[model samples]
Target: MVLHVVIASVAALAGRSVPSMALPKKRERAAPVVSAASSAMQMQPAPINPDWIIAGEPVARMADHSKSADRAAYTALWDCTAGTFRWFFAWDETVHILEGEVHVTAEDGSVHMLRTGDVAYFKAGTWATWRVDTYVRKVAFLRRPFPAPIAFAYRLKNKLLPAKTPTL
Candidate 1:
């Protein structure tokens, strides 16, 4: 059956045995870790490539908050002054606007006006034009995604052996 083949492939790729019909054992929860609040962190200047700028000078600042255990994901606070520029996404990023606004135009001509409290996602390998009339501040969650084949295998493994929920 297709299901059997999928399970076998996923298990092999994961280098572990997974019972086809059984859930995986729950992982023990680690101690809670806390980082400094965003408001308390100092932002340092992060320069934008001059060649990417299309208009007025835009000053930008950022402060890193945390990174995942695998170093594949991170969170940061960022803010930029008024300017127009082409922005490239080297990794998957989801931004939660905290102050001001920005008008983003996609390569396909789709325009998104993001303001305070708004959220937007930009995928890896994409570029967009950003126009900020005054300022924009946001919390950005970034991740480096797994490759296509590996991602497929991971999904299959999760489907075959669903993760167990830890009890409080």
Candidate 2:
């Protein structure tokens, strides 16, 4: 598609290369290990939706967990190879970079750099472009996402009905 070509061209000009739109072969793997920290050596390439690719082949590896069937809370370790791509957040995510670097450009054009030990928050509904300068590794915490109005209401309720403190 024309969009893909445009994205690839723009990325090249920015000194980043993007892979073609062809779907890379998916390799089979065993179930992920649910743990507090990843061993790193066992991480595998994450499955990516083709529609999300922009340029040069960006690949991600992840080990993730969900709190429950309702999808309230989630956590994951994600690693990505050097590449450029688009990310649309549907859940509030807080990421702590463990290795490498990334430059993220928000929809408003503001740019942020994330490097080792840096933490970044992406609210639900945010649109951004992520250009990975080097292979990167991160640990991410994801909270249940809500629409604007619902989110506001939830916050207000929490303030009104605070949890009771236990007396010693």
Candidate 3:
């Protein structure tokens, strides 16, 4: 559910339209997949929109791990230097802090201090203010959801025709 939201949000943020829920015409077997250690993955600069910065210059970096076939979901490693900024969640995002810490203030005036090993979820279409004192790193899981009508149809179809497990 959250994954779908994230994907939708990401698509919006990227100026891309959300993909339809329809399956591809040709079904193909998926290949085995693996990712290198986070420490070994090269991080690329992912600059924050200048207008979103409130205080100090924050430097951000990111490394993508994997993306779903339909491009509706993905995981990535992200980090940032000390700074205060407004983060607009374009997608549903669940983040697991890996290093350092950050203070996040939601639009509702609630504040959360997320440290190493902490996990937090940010809903799509929301905004939060983040303050990173020194540095912070996290793994972000994101997903885009189907439209309401399409989601309902999918749910109804699943209930009517449940998939059967294949015999090994």
Candidate 4:
């Protein structure tokens, strides 16, 4: 239905009439399917020393940063193996696990087991412990917290002066 509408619209815009079939002269190219692991591998993540460690041995990390916008938004591919540690998030993070298994314990002691194809979110100021049983590879999207006064001002400005959309 959408294709038909698009064909009709294109014909109208070109000042041409559409045939009953309205078949295209050329075939569309097929896009290749890319696996998450394959794409992460393409990232060429670099090994780095763990910044913080709480218990057991320190885990090894390989990370590739895809983007960092004003230190506000960050996107990365991270891989870690064999360690357990506590974290206090200063930023909000959303992670999609691509490989391995992990057990995450919240501040209140609720445990969440995550494995391949699982996703989790950690809010700013939230405390959690992560136990990587074997290994874990994930894509993370993080948003750092803004200063309270700046955040309040930005919110007030947006509320008072909403954006205007121009008419065509």
Q: 32-58 in candidate 2: lDDT tens per residue?
A: 555554674457678556687788788
Q: How does each model score on lDDT?
A: 0.88, 0.76, 0.88, 0.69
TM-score of 4: 0.59
TM-score between candidate 1 and the true structure? 0.76
Tell me the RMSD of model 1 versus the true structure: 7.4
The true-versus-predicted C-alpha distance at residue 38 of model 2, in Å, is: 2.0
Which ranges of candidate 3 are over 4 A from the true structure? 1-30, 152-168
Q: Estimate each model's TM-score.
A: 0.76, 0.66, 0.74, 0.59
Name the weakest run of 10 consecutive residues (lDDT summed) in model 2. 11-20
Candidate 3: minimum summed lDDT over ten consecutive residues — where?
Answer: 11-20
lDDT of 1 at 78: 95
Candidate 1: deviation at residue 161, Å?
7.3
Which residue pairs in model 1 clash with each other?
none
Say which prediction, candidate 1 or candidate 4, comes out ahead on lDDT.
Answer: 1
Pitting candidate 2 against candidate 3, the one with the higher TM-score is 3
Candidate 2 at residue 161, lDDT? 65
Question: For candidate 2, what is the lDDT?
Answer: 0.76
* lDDT by residue for model 1 (25-140), tens: 87555336847877898999999999999999999999988887656988999999999999999999999999999999999999999999999999999999999999999999
